[model samples]
Target: MLKIGLIGLGPIGSLHIDNLTSGAVKDAELSCVCDMRKVDNPKIADIPFYSDIDQMIKEGGADAIVIATPSFTHFELAKKCLLAGKNVLVEKPISLCTADAKKLEALAKDCGKICAVMLNQRTTPIYKRIKEMVSSGEIGKVNRVSWNMTNWFRPQIYFDMSAWRGLWKGEAGGVLINQAIHNIDAFAWIFGLPQSLRAWCKFGKYHNIEVEDEVTCYMEYPENMTATFITSSGEHPGSNRFEISGDKAYVVSEDGKLKIHKFVGGSLREFTLDTKYAFGTPETVETVEEFEGKGGQHAEVMNNFVSACLGKSKCDYDASQGVLSLTLANAMLLSSFKNSEIPVPFDDELYAKILAEKQASSELRKEVRKDFILDFKKSFR
Candidate 1:
């Protein structure tokens, strides 16, 4: 078994505790825990709990650590563990900046320890099937990928409840980085990274926060494929829809169902050139599929991390996958901020300059607020 210490007891961290204790993850034990606030759960009533992370790092009993902390604290926390030669599983976006994320990646490689991210959306069977189909040419040359994930609706109190909930200096970014990032990760998983992008985002569109809540971006990928991504916390009764239009088929996943239409004829380009008809489309076959049952999301991520640490299996949710999502989010953000199209492989230094400038003026109100809200259920794309 892989002895584990989970740091941070935020809502997600607390949920993870239940999952880990429920025997959902095989070959794992939540032997230790550390959080700034008191963890009063019955599940971990006897496990080691520390209010200070440094103390836990020094004396906590564990072979590996799971970082379920805030966005900005990931790199530093993982840095300590990597230096200690312990495996780590960090939450999404990995680090606030690509450079910082890269540093952890290099450190993990240098230390020869397993480092994974909590991209649990990848564990979803629907997305798993989508990735398999795209890789198997079921889509046959993706030409357009558009995802409108506007279902993340947050009220003002939700933002004001925590200082780092939605600030550039705090949570590092908003919708694209925080809420709809699963979609971003899923997009990258299915389509890979794009070559260039142009984005537009609105700050504080519906809340008192200092980061973007509404965003729309256009991106271009390899082989002239293109995509449009839009997300918002401002729209109520919003919709979660993912659409991918490729040469051979069009697939969409929405409302808990997967729908696809496969073209029976040759590629559209070939048909367009050979056909004598002015405007006629090819015959197509449509299929709709749905997946049932859950697959141990967060717990599965932890189990995979433990298995990888034991050299039994490799964790696919490594720093590269983490960086891919962060890179796309950062590119969209920097592009929107500069009001210019940004090329792929964005300049990390330039992004640092931009984020620093934004941080310079950001004023996140400090307060002795409630550390944890007991209601532990929420959803996002």
Candidate 2:
């Protein structure tokens, strides 16, 4: 069995614990868990638990470490694991910034160890099929992409549960960094990273936090394509629609159903050039596909990570892929701060300065901290 060490005991972390103990991941066992809190919980009552990360790594005898702590702590924790020659898997939004993400990636490379991200959404069939459709040229030369994923609703009490829930100093960002990150990463994974971005972000518009809760971003891709990303934590009964328009077909996916309209014989360019009449277009066919069941979400990712550890395969979500979406998040936030379109791979120092300002501002504000309850089942839909 592949021995695994886990950090953090929050909702997400505890869920990982459950999956490992439940035999949801083949050939993997949760040998140790680390958190600052007392580890007498009945869920992990018999497992070895540590209050210190270093103690867990040094004495736990784990072959791999999974970091599920806060977003800002990922870099240091992952680095520690990598330097110690242990494979590390970090939760989403791999790091708050690009430089730190790259640093962990480099450390893993230097140590020749595995570093993966819990981008379980990538394993979903809807997105995987969509990626194959677009990348495989089934949707010819996609030009316009739009996703309005605003269903990630959060109440003020959710933010009040922790001082760092929606704050920039702790979580780094609000929606785009926290909830919409899966969609953002999926965007980068399917459509490729954009060349530039212009965005308008609303900080603390819906919650009593010091980071963005609402945002609208316009991104420019290199292949003469453009994309729009609109998200918020303020909207109720929101829609999760992702649309892509291409030269040969158009696609819209919503609620696990994918709809496509394809021109019969010619691409848009070919039809425009070869059409006999001014207003006539090529014939079209409509195809609809619906997907069901979570096709190996977090469990699938863990299975793959364990397989990689056993030399059966390589890690599916490497650290490089993990940082691609984070770069976009950083760019959009920086562009909103500057009130102008910013180039891809944003300036690290400038973003740090902006984040420092927000951190200082957040420190000045007084907020109530509610007791945190652990119930991972109700956390995600």
Give lDDT tens digits, candidate 2, residues 1-381.
899999998878877987898889899888899998975567688889899899999999999999999887888899899998899999987888887888888888899999999998888899999999999999999989999999988888888867567877788899989999988989999988888899999999988787899999999988789999999998998899999999989899999899999989859889888888988977889999999986888989999999999899988898999988888888889999999999887787788778777777664226565565646565864
Model 2, residue 3: what's the lDDT?
95
Each prediction's TM-score versus the true structure: 0.96, 0.95
Best by lDDT: 2
Error of 1 at 15 (Å): 1.5
**Model 1, poorest ten-residue lDDT window?**
372-381
For model 2, the run of ten residues with the poorest summed lDDT: 363-372
Alpha-carbon lDDT, every model: 0.85, 0.88
Displacement of the residue 72 alpha carbon in candidate 2, Å: 1.9
- Residues 1-381 of candidate 1 have per-residue lDDT tens digits of 988899988778887898789888778899899987896788989998899877887788788999989887898999999998788999887988888889999999999988899998888888898899899998888888888888888877677777788888877799888888888888888788888999999989888788899999999988889999999989988988889888888899888789999888947667767888888887889999988854557877888888888889988888988998899999989998889999988999889788988888876768735654534456422
